[model samples]
Target: MDKFKKVQDVIASVEADVTKFYEGGNAAAGTRVRKAMQDLKVLAQEIRAEITDKKNSAK
Candidate 1:
């Protein structure tokens, strides 16, 4: 749970940065922002996998 929260916090922080860059109107920054978003998605998937494994193991 703590690890999951930490990942969520990182994703939220990166998302905020992405929004800032996009609103500032920098094309190159937008590319980086998009890449960060992609990474956040992967983090989310990993967190979900961890949760699923815990659930399956409990049974």
Candidate 2:
């Protein structure tokens, strides 16, 4: 749940930048959006690993 909230927070933080990049044609915002995407990837991987570990432990 904590990691899920973190993922949501990351997306929320970048929502404006995503709009600026696509709708307003801002290069800097695009850069920020890219970084946020990378962060999201890492967070997603971490959550995957956590779930795997917990499931395996429960079995």
Candidate 3:
């Protein structure tokens, strides 16, 4: 759950950069967006693993 929250926070944190990159054409913001996306991918993988672990344990 904490990792899930971190996922949400990452998404929220990236929103400004996403907007800046798309609407304002900021290259730095686009870089940040890319980094944030990488972070999101890692976090998602972790969450998926955690869920699988929990499910297996419950059964």
Candidate 4:
């Protein structure tokens, strides 16, 4: 639950950064935004894994 919350927060932050980058019109910002988005995606996957592991362990 806590991990999911943290990941969700990170995702929100990354989303905000993406929006800022899109509005800023800087080429270099694109790379940073892409990287942040990728990291957030990976964090989401990790959160899924954590939930799955918890479920499996309970069973």
Candidate 5:
């Protein structure tokens, strides 16, 4: 559950960065957005694995 919140926070940050980059063409914001996207990918995978493990254990 904490990991889920962290992932949500990162996604919000990425959204902000993307909006900032589009509004002002900031290279730094673009870089941050890219990094956040990569982080999101990893976090999503981790959550997926955790859910699968829980589901299998329930059986």
Candidate 6:
């Protein structure tokens, strides 16, 4: 649940940065968006692994 919350927070921040970049074309904001995307990808992988582990344990 904590990890899910963290992923949600990162997603929200990325959405904000993307909006900022699109609104004013800020290069810094674009960079931040990219970094946030990388973080999101990592978090997604972690969640996937956790789910897989849980399923295997259940079986």
**What are the C-alpha RMSDs, in order, of all predicted structures?**
2.3, 0.5, 0.7, 2.2, 1.2, 1.1
Model 5, backbone clash pairs (residues 3+ apart or across chains), number: 0
* Candidate structures ordered by TM-score, highest first: 2, 3, 6, 5, 1, 4
Candidate 1 contains a number of clashing pairs equal to: 0
Cα distance off (Å), candidate 1, residue 21: 3.0
Kindly report which residue pairs in candidate 6 clash with one another: none
Error of 6 at 51 (Å): 0.1
Please give the CA lDDT of all the candidate structures.
Answer: 0.76, 0.98, 0.97, 0.75, 0.92, 0.90
lDDT of 2 by residue, 1-59 (tens): 89999999999999999999999999999999999999999999999999999999999
Which of candidates 3 and 4 reaches a greater TM-score? Answer: 3
Candidate 4 per-residue lDDT over residues 18-37, each given as its tens digit: 76678977667677778866
| Displacement of the residue 7 alpha carbon in candidate 6, Å | 0.9
Model 6: lDDT to the true structure: 0.90
The digit string of per-residue lDDT tens for model 6 on 1-59 reads 77789999998868877988999898999999999889888988999999999999999
Lowest lDDT sum, 10 consecutive residues, model 6, at 11-20
Superior by TM-score: candidate 1 or candidate 6: 6
- Candidate achieving higher TM-score, 1 or 5: 5
Report the candidate with higher TM-score, 3 versus 6: 3
**True-structure lDDT of candidate 5:** 0.92
Whole-model lDDT, model 2: 0.98
Question: Model 3: runs farther than 4 Å from truth?
Answer: none
lDDT of 1 by residue, 1-59 (tens): 76677677767767766776768876776777778767678878888999999999999
Which has the greatest TM-score?
Answer: 2
Alpha-carbon deviation at 40 in model 1, angstroms? 0.6
